[model samples]
Target: MNDILIQNTTAFFEKSFGSVPQKVVLSPGRINIIGEHIDYNDGYVLPAAIDKIICFAFEKNDSKKSKIIAIDLNEEFEIDLTQEVKLSKVVWTNYIRGVIKQLQDNGFSFEGFNCVFSSNIPVGSGLSSSAALECGMIYGIKELFNLDIQKLDISLLGQKAEHWVGINCGIMDQFSSVHGLENKVIKLDCNTLEYEYHNADFKDYSLILMDSNVKHSLFTSEYNTRRIECEEGLAIIKAEFPEIKSFRDCSEEQVLNLKNKMSEKVFSRVHFVVKEINRVVKACEALDQGNIEVLGQLLFETHYGLSQEYEVSCEELDMLVNTAKDDDAIIGSRLMGGGFGGCTINLIKKGHENDIKSKFSNLYLDTFGIELKFYDVKISNGTTLL
Candidate 1:
C-alpha cells in the first residue's frame, strides 16, 4: 500500500513539476486508544501512529516562490518565501502556510521549494491527518535546509501550526506523528511532555477503526465549551484545594465532595477527565501485562464516560459501540479522538476482522443510512524519509 502511495505521489510530482522530487517524507496519522479529552487537562494519553500516512515529495526551486500541490485535493498554491507568511483563503493551504509561519516565528527562514503531497488517512475520521501534513512538511523542510531542529521540536512546531490555523489542538497528534514506534503505544504525560513506550502486541487481535461517517456540527464549539467548563471547575476547586493542580491531580472523591459547588455540566466535565486519566494508567498496565480483556473493558468504560459524562459521543458513535457489544470476537471498542463524531477504535480477534467489519457495516448502513468506513490499522513508526 505504501509503495503504491509512493509511486502515485512520485508520478504526480513528476507530472506536476516536470521533474522528480529531491526529498520525500512520510508522516503517519494517529489513533488514541483509551485516553480522550484528557490531554488538554494536563493528563496522560495513550496514542499510536497508524500505517495510514501522508507523503510529501519536494524539490528546491530556483525562484523565491514555493509551489505546493495537494495531490488528493487536486489543488495548488504558491507562497513567496521572502514575504511574511499569512493565512490562505484556501483551507488546505493554511496548514502549510501555518507551518511556515511557525518556523518563521522561531527565527528560521525557509527557502523556496516545490512540494507535492498526498495522504491515505481518511479525512474527518479522527486520524489526525492535519498533524501528519504539518509534521511531514516541517520535517521535510528541516532536512531540505539542513536545520538542527530535533524531532520533539518538530512536533511542537506542527502543533503550533495547528493552533495558528484555529484548531487549538493538543500536542498528542503531532507528538505521535513524530515519535511513533512500530508495535508500541506511547504513554504521554501531557503536562510534562514525558513519555514511555509500551509494547502493544495484540497477539491474536487487530486494531481497527470504524468511521461513523457523520461529523456533527457541534464538534468545534462543544470542544471549546468543554475546555471552558473544565477551567471553571478547576477554578472553583482550586479555591478550596490549593494543592490540586489539574484534573490529573484531583481524585474522584475530591471532585465528588465539591460536586455541590459546581454545576452539573462542569462536574461531569471534570469527572470525566479525572476518571479518564486514571483509566489511561490502568490501560497502560493492562498493555504491559498483555491482558487484552482488561484493556477491552477499559475501552468500553471510556466510551460510556465520553457518552454520558463528556457528552462527546453522538448516536452514530454510540450505535457503533452498541452494535459490537454482544460480539465475543470484539473485545474493546470506544469513540476515539475529539469525539462529537469520528471513528471508534476496536480491538478485534484477528480472524474475525472481516466478519466483524461486514456485520458492523451493514448494521450501520441500516441504522443511519450512512455507509461505514473501516481501516485495519497496525502501529507504525512516526514521520520518516522514504
Candidate 2:
C-alpha cells in the first residue's frame, strides 16, 4: 500500500511539475482506544496512529505563487504566499491554506510550493483525515525548507489550523498523527501535553474499523453543543467543589450531586466525561497488566456512556454496537470519533475477523441500505518522509 501510494503520488507530482518531487510525507490517521469526548474536558485520551494515511509530494517552486492538487478529488487550488492569508471557499483547500496560514502566523516565513496528495483515510469515518492532511503539509514543508520546528509544535500547528478551518477540534488527532510509534499507544494528558507510550501487542486479537458509512447532518452542531454542555456542568461543579479543576478532577459523586442544579442534558454530559475519564485510567492499567478482556469491557461501558449519557449517538450507531453483544469473538466495539455516524473500532480474534465483517456488512445493508466498509488497521509510526 505504501509503495503504491508513493508511486502514484510521485507520478502525479512529476506529471504536474515536469520534475520529481523534492519531498514526500505520509501522515496516518488516529484511533482512540477508550476515551472519547474527554480531550477538551482536560481528560487523558489514549490514541494511536493507524495505517490509514494521507500521502503528499512537495517541491519548492521558488516563487510566491503555489499550486496544490488533490489527487483523489481531482481538485486544484492555487495561492500566493506574499498575499495576506484568507480562508478559502473550497473546504479541502482550507486545510492546505490553514496549515500555511498557521505557519505564517507563527512567523515561520517560507516561499510557496507545489503539492500533490492522495489519501486512503475514509472520509466522515471519524479517522481524522483532516489532521493527516494538516500534519502532512506541515511536515513536508518543514523538511523541504529545513525549518527548525519540533514534533510537538507540528501537532499544535495542525490543531490551530483546524480551529481556523472551523472544526474547533481537540489536539488528539494531530498529536497522534505526529507522535505515534509503531506497535504502541500513547497515554497522553490533554492538559499538560505529557504522555507515555504503552505496548499495544494483542497476541491473538487484531484491531479493525468497520465504517457505518452513515453521517448524521447534526454532527457539527451537536459537537459544539456537547462542548458547551460539558463546560456548563463543569462550572456548576467547580462552584460547589472549589478544588475541582476540570472534569478530569471532578468525582462521579460530585457530578451526581450537582445533577439537580444543572439541566438533565448538561448533567448527562458531565456524567459521561467523569466516568469516561476514569475508564481511561483503568484502561491504561488493564493494558499494563495485559488484561485485554478488562479493556474490552471498558470499551463497551464507554459506548453506553457515549450513547446514553452523552447523547451523541444515533440509531444506526446504536444498532451497530448492539450487534456486538451476541458475538463472543467480538470483544470490544464502539462508535468511534465524534459520535453520530462513523466507524466502530473493534477488537476481535484474528480468525473470526472475516466472518464478523461479512455478518456486519450484510446486517447493515439489510437494515439501513448503507454499505458497511471495514478496514484492517495496524499501529503505525507518525508522519514521516519517504
Candidate 3:
C-alpha cells in the first residue's frame, strides 16, 4: 500500500462526504506475461496483477441514493439505488454503474454508498485500468455489504459489468485483477475458469512495458471483427471435425489440413489462434522448468504470429518488438493486449533497463516523431481492503 495516496483519497472522501469511509480497497492493473489475443478463442493466458492500481474509498449512506466521485477526473455521479440504474452519459461512470446493476440484478441488496476513487494505472497503455476500476468497485462493495461473494464470482461479475458497459472483453483481465498473487502469474483456462499460479521469478531479467503511445482508430472496430472472424473460422472447422469444442481442443495440424476450404483471412486467424494456444502451454512448461530463455523465444514467436497471422500488430508495435528482438540485452518482447498500438511487454537484462529505455524512446521519436512512454511494473497481489 502507498500510504500517501491512500491517505489522500481517504481524506478527500471525508471532506466530500462529511464522514470517514467505511472501506477502502486497492485494485491492481494486470499484465499478460505471454498470452495475448488468444483469450477469446478459449485459450489459456498468463496474467498477473501489477503494482499499478485504482484506490477506491467507499462509505454507506443513510439514504437510498448513491454518490460517487472520480477524484482524478474531477467528476461526480448521483443515483437512486432503488430506481433503475440507467447507463450514464458519462462514460467512466458506466463501469461503476454496471457493477451496481450486476449486484442488484443478481438479488444482492446493499445500502446506498458514497465512493471516491483515483487511479495510478495509465488508461490507454493496455494495462487494463477499466477492469481494475470495475473489479475494485465490486470487491469494495462486497466488503462493505459483507456479501457472500468469492473471488471467482467477483471476477465473473466484473466481466458481466464490462459487457454491460458494451465491451465484449474476455475473462482474463478481470480474473487476473481479482485473483492475483504476489510474484505469481496465473495460467487461466478461459473456458473452464480453472487456473494455476506459477512463479514469476524473472531472476536477472526485468519486465518492462514500452508504450508506443499510439492507438490507431482501428483498435475497437477491429477487435469486434476479430471475434467474429474467429467464430466464422471455428464454425467451419467444427462442422468437419465433430469432436472439436474450441481452439483449445483443436490443433495446428487440423487448422492446416482444412486450409484449402477456409478463406485465406479466416485460415490465418485460426492458425494464429491454434499456434498461440500451444505457445502458451509451452510457455507454462518453460517457466516450470526454469528455462527463461525458452520462454523468451516463445515471446518472439508470439509477436510474429500476432503481426503476420493475427493481423493485430500495428507498425509502431511491430517496431517495438522487432527492436527488442535484435537487442542481446532483451530476451523476449511482444505487443501486449488487442494490439493496433499499445505497449510491448519486454523481458530484459536487469542492468540494461536504463539504456534500453533511452535507446527505444529516442529511436521511437526519430522514427515516428511521437514521444514514447515506458513503465517499470512488478507482479502484486489482487484486490484487497487497504
262-305, model 2: which lDDT tens digit per residue? 99899989999999999999999999999888888898899999
Which segments of candidate 3 are over 4 A away from where they belong?
none
Error of 3 at 65 (Å): 1.2
List the candidates ranked by TM-score, beginning with the highest: 2, 1, 3
Cα deviation in Å at residue 93, candidate 3?
0.9
Q: How many Å off is the CA of 36 in candidate 3?
A: 1.2
Q: Write model 1 residue lDDT over 12-72, tens digit each, in one string.
A: 9999889989999999999998789988889999999999999999999988899999988
- The local distance difference test score of each candidate is 0.92, 0.91, 0.92
> What TM-score does prediction 2 earn?
0.99
lDDT of 2: 0.91
For residue 232, what is the lDDT in candidate 3?
96
Assess every candidate by TM-score. Answer: 0.98, 0.99, 0.98
Candidate 2: which stretches are off by over 4 Å?
none
User: How does residue 228 of candidate 3 score in lDDT?
Assistant: 96
